[model samples]
Target: MKWMEFSVHTAQEAVEPISNILHESGASGVVIEDSNDLVREWNGAEDEIFELSQEDYPDDGVLVKAYFPLNSFLKETVEEVKQSINDLLQHNIDVGRNEVTLTEVHEEDWAQAWKKYYKPVKVSNFITIAPSWENYQAAADDELVIELDPGMAFGTGTHPSTVLCLQLLEKLIKGGEYVIDVGTGSGILAIAAAKLGAKKVEALDVDETAVESARSNSSYNHTEAAVTVRQNNLLENTKMKADVIAANILADIILRMVDEAYERLNTNGCFITSGIIASKKDEVKKALLQSGFAIVEEQMIDDWVALVAQKK
Candidate 1:
């Protein structure tokens, strides 16, 4: 199906509010460009990395996205959203929030057309992701594994959240320990843990696409992680305890699920939650504390936050 593409460029700061308006009005996807105004096409990577879309970025934080349904009330929504954009433009704001770009996608497959862009990506010292369309080679001398392919849910390891998770996974995961990955998009975190030598891994996602994608990727890793991919909200399918729990989910979800995370922990085990907004860190911390966890450390990259907590 064809789509109407909208490229709304404004001071990066206004991107988020504009995106909220567009999404509320019904946008399938929104791309928020970086400070450098780069909405990257990591060459075949796809997935919603966080609750925040490109519309949430600032300073050249442009929204370039399209939604299928050419004959919908897209024009009315665009015009209505433009009023908000213009109000921002009328104000003296940061550099990225001053301009707006809008356009329509006259033709192209709005569905399943992103597959051609998926390719192999190297994330860490011994890890690489190869989609089903690509091939991966591991040197015998090198400790390498983390084979994955594109899926509908998220986490091909190219996204900021996934990248952050992989970075932390590289630092935290050691050999022969139980690991649990909540919101296991494409099984990226689970696959990373398995590659890092987790004795057993439990990967779960509410989305069926994510479950299937993760299972397919695990097969490619050849390391054979005992992964249980399920369609529950969080930790609903697993009664098995864990030494580590990784959650790359939205702030609200993290706060709501902190108790479950603490309940499933194996004393002193780490709970790593990313995909939090810098603004919501305090609330998440409070939730963690209420759930009997102490903040071990907190890290931020751009607007995203990664909190490392330990069970008491």
Candidate 2:
């Protein structure tokens, strides 16, 4: 089979949103090449350390790449992706150069290109994300490993927004609590909640591919019994109540569902939100507050911010 590599040259702030745009366009996988990775500090895990060539990255900005099966609709999909990314600017997101290019590649080459960049890394004190192909052992007795084949979706759980969500889940989940993961790409957070002893977890995604990927990842982690993946658009008209509701999506989407999130959560329940750029941090916080949530904690990594808010 043939694949079309859709690559974008943009600022670091645009990577997450553009990657999401590509994934929602039905791309089989996404790859991010950020120049900052060269000098970026890792958490110092032995397995996380690897040689990164300076040549594979852009000189000034980040390159976001995604693979789509070569088909007649490929051109149309690319246009839609470009438009969706351009829409990010309305939200005040910096898209940088926003240069896009497409290249043809064999299935084998595209598959091999992205795999070498993924490896096992602990995202939180208790949870670690390992690629499905890697044989990673827990360094501690309390470690919880989430094995994911991220080719199906845009999440590897290594992005700072995701890492922040994982860390908050580790600290908040006290076992046997019901959790709802909105926009559950790759089902990473739902899987982590289950591994952390959530009695039941419902992982929701609007994209069928993401729902399938989340299900696959949950099964791989043996959390399928506790984690359920379904196609839903951000808690719309859902009667399910959860002890905790987690969303690691763009801040705009987060705001759209804030009221529903608060309503669907049980009394004194927690709402964990990530994928918020620092510039939009105050806007999101104000919305959560107006929705009757008291901001309890905030965590930041680089230009991204995550907040933990609670119902009174």
Candidate 3:
């Protein structure tokens, strides 16, 4: 089969949202090429061994590429993707050049292109995320390895937003706590919670594809019995009150669901939210506070922020 390779030149800040756009548009996977990865200093020779080819990357800014199956609607899909990305400008998001290009490639070529971008990444003290194809061993006895195929889902479990969520989960989740992971892309957080000893975890996502991916991932991690993946909107008529509720989603969505999150938690329950840009930190915090949640901890990585709130 043939594939249409869609490439966009966007700013670092726009990568997450743009990649999300592609995924929603039916792209099978995304490949991020950031020039910073080439020039940034690394602590050891591990990164140096990758041997990046300068010709494949832009001189500045970041390149995000994704693959869509060549179909009758390919042209229309591309146009829709471009329009959605252009819409980002209205949100005050810097889209950089925002130049989009398309090329035809065979399935084999598209498959090989994404592999170079994915590797084993240690996102937190206890969690190491690796692609299903990589051969990675835990460096420590306490390390938890999550193997993900990623596919078209939004969460890789290694993004700063996700890493922050995982780290907070590691610190906050004691044995037998009940967890509800909203927007549970790839089911990483729910799986992590289960692996960290959560007695029961419900992983919820509005997207059926994401819900399916999360279920498969949970099964792969041997947490299927502990983590349940379901299709549900954010805290909509949630029947179960959990000890912890995690939502790694946009700040606006988080704001909209803050009250519901509070209502769905048991007394003194923890609400963890990430996928917030630093610019919107104060706005999210205010909403959480107004919803009667006390901000207990805040974490920032790069330009993203995560907040841990407790119901009093």
Tens-place lDDT per residue, model 2, 1-312, is 999899899987898888877876888888888887777666646655677788888997889988899989988998899999999888788999999999999988977877777878767777878898888888889988888897635666788888899999999999989999999988999999999999999999998888988988899899999998999989986777899999999888998999999999999999999999899899999999999999999999878899999999
Question: In model 3, which regions exceed 4 Å deviation?
Answer: 36-57
**Model 2 lDDT, residue 174, Cα:** 93
Ranking by TM-score: 2, 3, 1
Model 3 poorest ten-residue lDDT run: 40-49
Please write out the lDDT profile of model 3 over residues 147-249, one tens digit for every residue. 8877744545656788889999999998999999999988989999999999999999998999999999899889998998999988886798899999998
* Cα lDDT listed for each candidate: 0.65, 0.88, 0.86
Q: What is the lDDT of residue 276 in candidate 1?
A: 70
The regions of model 2 sitting more than 4 angstroms off are none
**Span of 10 residues, lowest total lDDT, candidate 2:** 40-49
Q: Give the Å shift of residue 21 in candidate 1.
A: 12
Residue 126 lDDT (model 2): 73
- Spell out the clash pairs found in candidate 3: none
The TM-score of candidate 1 is 0.69
Give TM-scores for every candidate, taking all chains together and pairing residue i with residue i.
0.69, 0.94, 0.92
